[model samples]
Structure formats: structure tokens, C-alpha cells
Target: MRFTDLISYQALLEPSKPAIVAGGKIVTFGMLEHAVRSLSGRIHALGLQPGSLVGLSIEVPSRHVALSLALARCGLVSVPYASAATLSQLPPLALGLSDGGLVVGSAAINLVVTDEWFAPSEQPVPDVAIADDADCRVFMSSGTTGTPKPIFQSFGGMDAQAQVVANHHLLAGRVSRILCAMPLKSAWGYRSTIAALANGIAVYFAAGTADIPMTLAAYGCEYLICSVYQLQELVRLQSETMIPLPSLAAVCTGGSLVPAELVRSAQSLLCSRIILIYGSSEVGHSALEVAGMHPWQDGATGFVTPWTEMEAIAEDGRVLPRGETGELRVRSFAQARFGGQPAPDGELPWFYPGDRGSISPDGRLTISGRTVDILNIGGTKLSSERIEHALKRHPMVIDAGVMGVADRQGLTEVRAAVTVRGAVAEAELRSFVATSFPVAAPQMIKIVAAIPRGDTGKILREELRALLN
Candidate 1:
């Protein structure tokens, strides 16, 4: 079902229910639907084309959901942008989104074709959402070099994915409150904004990653669907019992493998179980831990929804046995993408988004790692995640980062940097790492107060590379 349909459903069935709570204000489903419909009229009144882009710059709350819904309702494409990217990055982000079309909003940057997008209501509309044969909904993803990739999305691709979320994750008759912590400019972030709304769950918006833990505590957020790094930080901060989480039910960690210790700790500390989900900006939220057992431990590691058809394929393009590990190729025509890319895989009905994972013997699923995050030591292939997971386990370490650095001789070295909770010398960490990975002892180590993180909580690899260099 399309995301817009849920608004109508909630408006009729539970119209007075809280649809959004932000900045000490609560908007009910009926009120939210009216706001969306009215805002959609305002958006359309801008004389934008049927599939042209309409930007939403709401910073405090309701930015993503309202904009996504209104644009979907009006048949105008909506492109959301995070206001926090570097100034040098904004201009390119705007130009990339505009694609020769008019731009809008003050949140991303100042308006106009050549400059950055504007903040919400802070700048004039950059471009009219005019008629466009081209795809709507431009999403920016982080490049390997730490640049943003402009991926287009069609309205159809979005709806198809929302159905999967509505069926697989959202339980019926259960009072759920979805916290929007991830920025909406990302496909995953935008989808999370609307996914709960698509299922008629009350939505709570956290200004950014900074506000998540406190905001989630304040709202008694039942379900948190956001990046794993943010969740990890939240779990870390919530290690103490003073933080109130009376209403929190499920901790949904995406963007990477949910740390098992984090899950167990959150369950003990905040009284909420971690629900681990594996997904991407391109594929939407896919395999979730199976329900039951501990709140954090899904009996199965793989997603079990009927809406999506998934296969694990090997390097040679052959489908792997269910018990083996491979790339996760999936298809869902019922869901919509940001661009008009034609149902992902077209005739084949599958999309392999460069993730490496496996389906277990018991039909459970586990995401081993991402294919894009490989590290080369000389010629040996090492999963960066494996090293990261190992490093985070150290008690004195708050965070750890590993990058492939080459020696003067040209042999690649597994270099590490760590943020510590207590005093830790480089040699001490090196000693620990040597004990752990005897074969691949890191030759270099740096003690940083905190690993530099991009807006998405990913360490800035380019910045780290600069550090190593």
C-alpha cells in the first residue's frame, strides 16, 4: 500500500491519536492529515511541475514526514536535505539535486541554481517544482571518497518499499511511536520518517543525532529506527539508570550490525530490548532479527517478511545455498524508489546492493559485512567491520577506527585510531591489538578523543586518510 493511504486510514480509524509530537507540541492524526493536505495545496500552488521537486526545510520537527507525505499526495517529488553538511559540500549537493531544475529552502544552503539550497522558510524557493519527465526525489549518499551521490527515486519505488515496512515491522493495534533521528535527505532517513507514519504510528522528530537520546527519553519513544552509531551512542549514554524510558519498547538499530553488547546493556539499563535490522539507503530496511526471545535478540538474523523476495548470490553470480553467505539480491516492485529507475532490476526482479551477508541454517539471517568496506593488507582481504568489532570490545575504548595505510615500502598496514574513556597509550592499545590479531598487528596507532564523524555517524574516511597520510 502507498504511504499516503495510511494517513487516510488513521484519519478515519484513529483520527484523534497523536500523529506527531515535537517541540512540546502534539499533532493528532486528523490534524496531521489536514496539515499535509493544506501544505500540499500550498506546495502545488507554488506552480511546481507534477513530478518536480518540493523541498521541506522544517528543522525542529515534521520536516521529513510532512514534506514526504504532502509531495506524495500532490504528485510532486520531494527532496529533503540535512542542514549540517560542510559549506564546501552544500553547493554541490544543491546543484546535484537541482539537476538544472529550480531549487528551494534555506536548510541545505541559499537558493538558486548555482548556490546551495535554503533553510526552511529562510530562503525563497530555488526552483519551481515544474513538470519534469525526469525522475523525482533526489537522495544524496556518501561516496567512497566521502562525497555525496545523487540517486533519483520515483514515487512508485517509495510506495513499494513502504508496504514492506508496514507489513513486516509495524504491528497492528499496538501503540507505536517512531522517532525520526536520521536526517531525511537520505533514502533510509526519509523512509524511516514516513514508514511509521505510513503505518499510522505517532511520529517524534529529533532535531538531529544530538537530540536523540534526550528526545527519545522525553517522548517515551517506543520504537527507535535510526543509524547504528547513534543508537550505540544512545546506549552508551543510557548506561546509567537515571534516564527515563518508561514508554520505550523497541530499540531498532540499522545502518550496521547492531552491537550485541549494546543490545544486552540497553535491555538491562533502559529496560528496552534492542531489535536489530539490516538495510541500506537503496534497499530500504531488509532483514530484521526474528521476533521473540530477548527484545534485542531476534530468534532469526534474517528478515522474514513475505513482501520482499530475496536471494543470496555468490561472487560468480550463482545463487548460494540458503546456509551460505553471499550478496543479498532482492526485488520489490510494490515499493517506490526516489528515482524512476524502473523497479530496480527490471525483468529479472532483483537488486544486489553490494552487501555481503548470509542466511543461516535455521532460515535466520546475518549481515556479515558490506562489500564496499573491504580492507587490503598487501593482497589479503580483511573485513574492516571485523577489526572494528574487535576494537570496540576493549574496555578502555569508547570508539575505534581502522584504515588501510601503506608503509614507505608500499605494503599496506592495518592502522587504528581510538577514542578512549580512560588513559590509554598507543603502545598499550597496540599491545592489546597484537594479542588479538597476532598475524595482523597494527603498525601504527593514534589516540584521538573522538573519531571524526560525518553527519550520518560514519567516520570520515577521507579525513582519516588525511590523518594517516
Candidate 2:
């Protein structure tokens, strides 16, 4: 069943239960259901047919969620974007849903909704039959490389992902509310919010980074969903104030590597465990590292989940054995290819997440770095993640990004850019990594104000290279 089906079930069982809490307002399951139906009718009245594509750029999280469900309920595909400016160029009839009305190329359709589309509507929504394999959503990639790629997802795939999320042990019992700090436009945020609502959990969307603490305390939220950077910032904030969050049980983080030092700082200061998940927009979740339960390793992501398949492969496409580092591939029911292309020969395609790493005999996964980010130093490949982690081990270094630059002889050499907490000599930092690489130590080190990062905390290699240049 789809997430909307689950919501309908929850509405019947517990109509009064709060499904969404935002800006001090609560929308119960019953209210949510009515709003979805009313909004569906409102959209259908616009002459938009079932299976039409719609873009959502609403700034309000609650409105975004409601409109998304409305789209799904009436068999329309929704493409949600983080930037409101993106809404200006959508295809005809594929209008962007804003807080005010439908936006089409700087013009508003004025499909106005009374009472914010919460009132019950006698207007009939299209009774379109939805097939499991029908296209439902288009998720945009993080775009660290360049332009974001559109990944199409089917209803069955979404259902599988939602079920996987709802049944995960970490979200079980008494974990009724969560503060989703990530924007709903992100795959993580939208999927998690829908999954929570389907399973009768309340979702609180933080207005901004500054609103996290107040919302968590006010709602007594037991769980927090955020990125690795946000967790670090929160830990720093808690360290300064020494305030306690008695309700917080854990922080689920992903989108980037969680440093061992940062994890320790969080434990000591925040009184909460950090759960580092490894996944992509194409694949839901591959592995997870839970603080306090697993030993800290430099690039350890964690063990593979039961629902997913993980393996390493060589350049020739042969699957590598455990302990042999190579490109990483993942297989899951929720996975989609880069461009909606089906695998050749009708074979089940394994999604190459562009990560270079290996799995141990016990099924643990360690991500070394992005496949594209690998440094070709004199024909010997090196993982930038490994180099960056080594540089970060220095006391003064706060963060680091490594790249390969060509010299006068056209030979590639290692180079690094770092953000430090205090003064550090370039030679001193170079010496720090000499012991680890000896042969391919960074020939040049540059101090930078900050490293460029995407929304989810992935280092923007292209941007970092530009900064270093």
C-alpha cells in the first residue's frame, strides 16, 4: 500500500492524533485527510489530469507536505525543489505550487483555496486507479558534480521505502515525534515525513537552524533527523550553553562522514547517541553506524542492512571479494538508476553510488571516498577521504578537503585545503600526513576560510578545487 493508504488507515483508527506540528499548530490525522482531499479537488478543478506533473516550491513545510499528499492522492506526480527560483521555469501545465497559488512563469493561476484547503469539499476528486508500478515522484540528486539529475520513483518503490523506514528498530515505541531539520525538498526529509505520518508519528519541521532546540523542548521530541554538519553545530551550541535535552534519545545523521572526534564530542556534551547512516537518493539506506554500539573507525559507515545488498567491484566490472577496496554498488527495492534507463539484457542493475570502498567478512562497509574524488598520484590511486581524515587528525585542523593537481611535467600530485581552528604552518600540516602516505604526501597545503559543501554535507570537490585554484 502507498503512504496515503496508511494515512487513511491512521485517520480511521486515530483521527485526533496529531500528524503534523508546525509553528505551534497541530494538524490531526482527520484534519490532514480532509485537507488532502480538498486540495486534490482544487487541483483537479484546474483542468489538470491525473498523471500530470506538478512542481512544489512552497516555503511552508506543512503546506508542502499537504500538497504533496494531495498530488499523490489524485494520481499526479510531484517534483519538489529546494529553491523557489526553480519554480519559474517549469513546463506548461506543470505549474509550481507556492504558498499563494499555482506559479507558471512569473504568473499566478490563482486557484485559490478557502481556509487553506482544509475545509471538507463536495467537489469530486478524480477517482483514478493507481497501479503499483506507476510513476509517482521525481527526486533530484544532490548535484555535487554539476546539474542535478532527475530520478524517477514508482509507487511500489515508495511503498517499499516507507515500509522499511516504519519498521526500523530505531524508530520503534515511544518515538512518537521527531524534529526533521532537513528541508522537505530533500529526499530524506520528504520520505521520512511521509513514513512517519503513515505510521502515526508526529513530525515537527524546524523553521530554521536556530529553531531546533526550542521546537524539540516544546514538543518533547525523542528523535532528531539531521545532517552531520548540523549535529556538529548542535553539539558546539550545547557545549557553550551546557543545556540538557532530557527528551532527546538519539540523532540520526547522514549525507557525510561523521568524524570520530565529533561523535565523542556529541556524546559528552549532548547526552545523545549519534546514528550515522550511509545511503543515497537512488537507494534508501545501505548501512548505518550507531554510536555507543559500534567501535569508531576512520571511514567506517557500518554494517549492511538486511533489506539491501552491498558489494565492491573492480574497474573491469568483476565483483571484488571482501576486504578488497573497489567501487561500491548497492541493490535495494527502492533503488533507481541515474537517468531512468533500464538495465541492458533485462538484468537487475546494481546502482553504483560512485563510492570507492570495501565490505568486510562480517558485512561492514567502509567508504574511502567518491570514485571521482580519487587522487591519481603518479598512477597510484589514493582516496581523498583517507587523506582528509588524516589531515583532520591534527589538533588545529577543523576540516579538510584534498584534490589532485597536475604539475609542470603533467604528473599529478596531492594538494589540500583546510579550515583550522587556530594558526597552523603549512609545512607542519604537510608533515602530519607524511607518515600516512610517505610517497604521495600533499605537495601543497592551503588554509581556507571554509570548505564548500552541499546541503547534505557532501564536500563539493569542484567548488573546493576552484577555491584552491
Candidate 3:
């Protein structure tokens, strides 16, 4: 079934049920259907055809959600661009990644739409038939390396992925209300919000990061979808003020490696189960870990999800046996599209995620680090994830990033940058890391205000390297 059809079905089943809560206004399913239909009629009047690429730069969560569903119902591929990006920055990125047929938003861009376009209309919205395999949405990558690339997915794939995420997070019938703390344009944010909506759950969008805890408490949300960094901030806030989220039961965190210490601290203060998810934009979710259900070990990502096939391969292209570390590869029925086409280059059956990891005989997946982030010091290879994990163990450290830097002699040494909650001596921090992991101690450590990160919380290694220069 098309993802848009799910909204109509929900409206039919529970029209009066709350579908979205944004900007202190509640929109019921009935109102959502009407708004989508009204906006869709306006879009159709513009003469845009099926499969046409429509760019969306709306910042309001309610409007973004409605317009996305409307674009899908009209059989148009909706590409949600970064709301904070400039018009000049968007066109080139959209042209290189998507078909770039039209742009729609409050910005003064080409084919711009005004407030009147989304005003309530009396015209009946026509039902546009859409093929199951037709591309329905284009999501931009986090753009950590360079320009963000457009990732496409079919209607059927999106529906299937939404179901998988909903089922995995227990959002179907158990969760009545959820708060999304990430940007609506992010893959995780968009997918998790739609998944909740598809399962007949109400979603609350926070005004900003600082307001997440208050939003959750005000809305009495039962679940929260946030990045690891956001979770860390929430934990810090809760610890300082002892704020109570009376209804919050589960907190799902992903987009980067979550420190075990952070998870333990959050679980203690919030009294909520911490679910760590490991996956990428290319693959929806490959592994999941629930607090107290499994032992949190270095690089452990918990059990692999049932929908995807995961394996570890050695340098010689040989699939390694369980308990051995190697490059992680995944094969799933719901793979993402690049430039409106399937990704991973070549005709290989499996998609290499470029993550170094290992799978246990019991089926638990442990992600060691990214292939590109591995550091070679005097021919001794070390995983950057391990060093970062060690640095994070310090009580004063809030976040840490480790990378290789070459010196005058072209010899690589491990350098670390960290964000701390309080004043801490660099020598003391380095000494702590050395004691924690003597074999992989960093040669130098710099205390910074914050580590540069992408939207999804992945460290920008190039940006961190620039600090050293």
C-alpha cells in the first residue's frame, strides 16, 4: 500500500484522534486529511505531473507532515530539503541529486508557494493513482563529507520500512503519544514520525533542543525519538533539575555510537528503557539493543534485526566466522536509492555499509568503527571508536572524538578532542584515557567547547582535523 493511503485509512478508522501536535496546536486525523487534500488540490492545479520532483523547505512540523503526505498522494516525489539552508545552496544540491523539477516553500526560490496556496479550499481533491514501485520520496544525506546526496525510496519500500520501525520500537498500539527531537528533514526523524502516524499514534514536535524535556512533559508523551547527542543533553538537564517525565516509557537513540555511560546515566535519571539503534540512511535499522536485556560491551550494537541479513567480511573478501572483527555488510529488501537508483555501486548482491564490526554466534552485532576512521599508528591499526569510548568513560567528559594526525615526519599519532561538562586538565584527561586503554592511548588531547558533528551526530573528522592545523 502507498504511504499516503495509510493516512486516509487512519482518518477513516479514527477521524477524531489526534494526529499531530505542533506549535501548541493539535491537529486531529480528520483535520490532517482535509489539509492534505486541500494542499494537494492546489499542487495539482499547478500542472505538476506524476514522478515530478517537488522540493519542500518548510520548518513547521505540522505543515511539513501534511505537505509530504499531499505530495505522495498526488504521485509526486517529495524531497524535503534542509530548512536552514539558503536558496542558493539548495538549487545546486537539488539539481545534482534529484530531478529538480520544482521548489515549494516560504523562501524566495523558484516555483515558490505562498501562504494562500495552502489556504483551505472548497474544491474536491482528486485521487491520483500511484504505482507501488514508483518513487515517492527523496531524502537528503547528512552531508558530512561534502554535498548532501538525494536518497530515493518507493512507496512500497517506505511503507514496509515504516512498519518495521514501528514494530521494532513498540510504537504500534502501546505508544499513544511521541515527541520527535531531531530535525524533521533527517531520515530518522521523518521515518519515525511517519511510522508513529501510520500506527495511529500522535506525534509532538519540539520547538527546539532546549525545549524537548518540557515538550515531552507538557504533551505527556510516552516515547521519544532523539539522537544520541540529544539524549545526552536531556540526561544532563534532568540530572541538574531533576525534571520528571511522568509518561515517558521508552527513549530510542541512534545516528551514532551511544556511550554506555550515557545510556546508564539516562536510564537511571529518566527511569526509562534506553534502546540503542545502529543503522544508516542506506539501511533502515540493522541492529537494536535494549537496556538491561543485554550486556553493553565495546562496539556492541545488540541483536541484528530480523528483516536484514548482516555479515562480517575479512580483507580478502572472505566471510569471517563469528567473533572475528571485519567490515560489516548488509542485505535488505528495503535498501535506499541514490539518484533514483539502487546504491552501493556495481552488481554486488550485498551493500557494504563501510562499518567495521563483528557478529556473535548468538546473533549480536558489534560495530567497531567506520572503515575510513581507523587509524594506523606506526603500522599498528587501532579503531577510533575504541579510543573515543575510552575518553567518554571519564566522568568530566561529555563527548569525545579521536582521529589520526600526521606530524612533520609523516608519522601518524592519535589526537583527541573532547567536550567536557566542567574544567578538567588535559594531562588528567589524557592520563585517564591511558589508564583505561593503555594500548591505544592518545598522544595529545584538546578540550574544546564542542565536537563538530553532522546533523545525525556523526563526527566530522575533517572539521576536527582542521582544529589541529
Worst 10 residues of 2 by lDDT: 104-113
Alpha-carbon RMSD, candidate 2: 3.3
The top-ranked prediction according to TM-score is: 3
lDDT of each: 0.62, 0.77, 0.77
Each model's Cα RMSD: 6.1, 3.3, 4.0
Candidate 3 per-residue lDDT, tens place, 1-469, comes to 6667787889899999999998899999988888888988877776666877666767677787988898888787777765434333433322111123334443333454555656788766868888767887777776655456666778877888898888866822278998888777777888888888887889898877678888888889888888877887788788888768888898888766667787889888875588878887777788887867876686677788888888999999899999899988886777676533254665425767678889999899887778887787767777787788788878898888898877899987888999888989988877887886665677888888889887667777778888755
Clashes of each: 37, 0, 0
**Ten consecutive residues with minimal summed lDDT in candidate 3?**
92-101
| Model 1 agreement with the true structure over 1-469: per-residue lDDT tens digits | 4557766687889889888887778878887676666655655555544654445444445534655676666666555654434223332332112324333433333333221211223222223333323345666665435666555666566666666666545532254777767666667666666667767778787766567777877877877766768866776777643577777766666666565666666677655455666655655666665334523332234553455567789888898998787877775544334233244443533556666777765556666666766666657676666676667777888887778776788877888787888887777776777675665556787887677776667677777777766
Q: How many Å off is the CA of 7 in candidate 1?
A: 0.9
The C-alpha TM-scores of every prediction are: 0.79, 0.88, 0.89
Clashing pairs in 3: none
Candidate 2 achieves a global lDDT of: 0.77
Q: Which pairs of residues clash in candidate 2, taking residues 3 or more apart in a chain or in different chains?
A: none
The lDDT-based order of candidates, best leading, equals: 2, 3, 1
Query: Predictions ranked by TM-score, top down?
Result: 3, 2, 1
